[model samples]
Target chain A: MIDAIVLRDAREHWRMLLSWAITAAALISLQLSVYPTVRESSAGLQQFIEQYPEVFKKVFRIEDYTSAPGYLGTELFSLMLPLVFIAVGAAWGSGFTAEEEEQGTADLLFALPVSRVRVMLAKGAAAFLSLTAVGIVCLGTLAVGTGWVDMSIGWRRLAAGTAVCVALGALFCALGALLGAATGRKGAALGISVGLALALFVLYSLAPLVNTFDAALPYNPFQWTLGSDPLTTAFTPGSVLKPVGVAILALAGAIAVFQRRDLRQL
Target chain B: MTTAPKVTPLRALPPAEPVLEVRGLSKWYGRTHALDALSLTVQPGEVVGFVGPNGAGKSTTLRILMGLVSPSGGTADILGQSALNGSPNVRSAVGYLPGSPALYPRPTSRECLRFLQRVRGIDCRARVAELSARLEVDLEKHIHDLSRGNKQKIALIAALMHSPRLLLLDEPTSGLDPLVQREVERVLREAAADGVGILLSSHVLSEVEALADRVVMLHQGRTVLSAAMADITGRLVQRLTFEFADTAAESWFEGVRGVAAVEAHARHVEVTVNGSQAAALDAAAKHGVIAVHSHEQRLEDVFTELIPERAA
Candidate 1:
């Protein structure tokens, strides 16, 4: 019964998930197509990267820009891939959870014997799975693309970076679900979650240049995702743990509000 | 147009136990009170009509019983459990059809029914087929393409497939044609005969009078009247008009028993009857009446008579 909600959502939105996976693979192939040029002029590019502000290099996780892990991390996972994952997660999270209320179907859904908490969790799970699918597809593309470009970004490193992206996306998914349930308005939920994600991303990007934000970076979700250079370094337990804990908190808050609120739309 | 007996003769009856009970149930949306200390009860095997005008707290009461909305203050019990936060099991025993029920447009009626059936942990393919056939529902059609009546049939099927112990229907026949309305009524009657308690809410007094064993009336969020259908028909004052063959005169029917007032003009005489109109009709016969007309007592008329200050 619980799976029924999740399954129906997946069936309804499989096309969205498939399109995102194709886009992620396309981006990876498009980026790797240029890796050979970077490798040919490694020393010159290394110097060019060093001339960037020390803060910018650190923010990009670019100690060795000529290497496959370094090149891919700076190009994709640093900004592009994380944004993709976050968008996918947020889209599914907000749209799926709030649609029943927005479309005036909550009267039918909530009238069932199922509890609201279960419905909330089911939607969160479906969104998380969509993000996970995109992450895996992105990882597969990166694995093959690095080899075709004559580089060795280790498989474990690729997995680590993708894991971080997925975890970050999951956190955003829970946040989107929370907003959707709290407001019962899909547009508002998606707008606020995306707005908040973009704001936090900007802060994370600029934090290295601003010493004042140094203390907060340790707790920031975006920081947890890429701050340690997961593609070049090992993925630590804390990397996934922090975002997961916050996701749980967000989901708990969502369930608490959703269970008690009156279905105003109906 | 219903011609059901105004008062049915008494027959041996089964013992009764109320499946729904409410006391002082009040709901306030901010400062606007929707239900004002309303009280009601529906016993097993009884079809109790919850009749009122639009915005008369009928929908609010039903929503509270379904636990879709909570009351500001009061107690409501459905099937022996508190209706405020009734559990899944409590709801499982009760089937509910919301007024203007919301359904997913993407799924065919069959798909929608399967999903709901799976949620209830039951396989209802046969019942689905049967109910769809009985209601003339197009199971293969997508809900978005279905007409309003067809969509309503889908919702009705969902409400009845589980064979629940109690049925809480809000304006169940609002959009139905006469033919389909009669079919739904027949289905409800059959369910009631199986000892199911039914609370049917509608603004149409005639519909309730024809089907309900008892009727409760609401006005401005408060219960203004509650009684058996027979008692309601008997207690209500009605008007009758008699057309004369010759000159219309107030004198011929004067002082007739049960005739409260008479106004005459042209070839017709209008009489207000307090109880039996037999005496007045007898007088009209002697006066060579050519035609007779009974002014039906609509639900709105009842509201005007019972709560003139507020209803006006």
Candidate 2:
């Protein structure tokens, strides 16, 4: 296990990984605990939701707040859950190579017998595993919450939604790794990662306001992950496959660039 | 009465195969030339000291041999395998300490050693313990909390624990105190005795003179000189101070065959002899030399003369 870079990374970053998992679990639990309160005041809450602006409701995906999946989607998975996963993915990807180079440790690492491609793959595996861990924590909390609240939410649908979240998280993680490998600078990688994430999210959120962007919804990662509201809509292969495919392409490009480029010191 | 024995001409023997061989290695970083057709070899059980100023390509040469960087031209081989490809089997036989080694800051020294051991596929727990004990390194201390000297000890242990066939050390004693440096020198000598070929790059000329079997000097990314330690010793200048019965004119020694430079005072004369001291002493005796004293040449002086630009 120590020989594999992925396991090594996990061992080194266990504290951060655990913190992310706990954060995801805590957020999900808090959102689920408020379900009964929201249900009891459904009539008044529906009145308040109706008064919300049309664009605001569209951006937040607010529809039938009394429904379990809809409530969870808005309160948990929609923004908060994906945000947690995105941050985790971006951090892992950037820290893998960029942080090592910045800290002057790349020379020690690259001097080993292992090829650079293998090292990059190991880092990608670690990031994927960490993101999956956070997704699992969120899924487990949602499952337990449903049982505690006696909600009629299907476990199968919850599992499917969590899978989509993992894929979406992986896309951003790959993006961060690509930028880090190309630039060898943690700040640049992370800044571009967060900026792109925000830009794609805004583009997807305001798609209804612009006809051209609405037509380009298929190209937006945010639309791929949040467009269908995985909890309420039927699972589509395109939703998961497109993001996963894009992630693979990004990772391939990263590996190629890293292979040819010289490793620089801080 | 004794008679001189008959002398016979000696025949040159074939050269032995080198444990490490580099040929015409060149590295260019855009418009900058880091190394220019540098070639060298280290035979088994030999320690070759690489001496140069900063940016003189000592680190670049070592890095290329370790496969950390690719050369723009030429090839490097260790144990008959190309270092550029750096197969695992080939790398497992090599121990390298970079100019500035960086270990994981979070792990203890022991953990880092264990991780490297696993990576290298060496089952030498006893060796690790022995190296740590010899180096006086506390294995349980976190790397970030350790002093620079202690950190250097850990790096040294990691490089030596594997007992590799070839050791590529760059400034191995940079942060070490005198005692630790002596200890490390002892370890290197022991490794050499056991037939490990070592290529040590350092700016410390005295250490190089003390430990190297051969010295290779680099200047401005080029090999300025490569000579056996004995040859260097033979060519080393000797400073001769003479007190003549009478004032000796500097011109009296100006035409001496072995004297490189001469200085004359009212009653004392000093001459730097690069060849036989006998030749210079013979010339000084003609000036009615009353007394003579000689000082052995220092490697620092030789280094300055070899790389005069650096001295400037």
Please give, for residues A181-206, the per-residue lDDT of candidate 1 as tens digits: 88888889989998999988877887
Give stretches of model 1 more than 4 Å off.
A53-61, B1-15, B286-291, B298-300, B303-312
CA lDDT, candidate 1, residue B102? 78
Candidate 2 chain A lowest-lDDT run of ten: A1-10
DockQ of 1: 0.45
Q: Which sections of candidate 2 miss by over 4 Å?
A: A1-3, B1-15, B244-257, B282-291, B309-312
| Count of residue pairs whose backbone atoms collide, per candidate | 0, 0
CAPRI-style quality class for the chain A–B interface of candidate 1: acceptable
Q: Clashes in model 2: which pairs?
A: none
Give chain A TM for each model in order. 0.94, 0.96
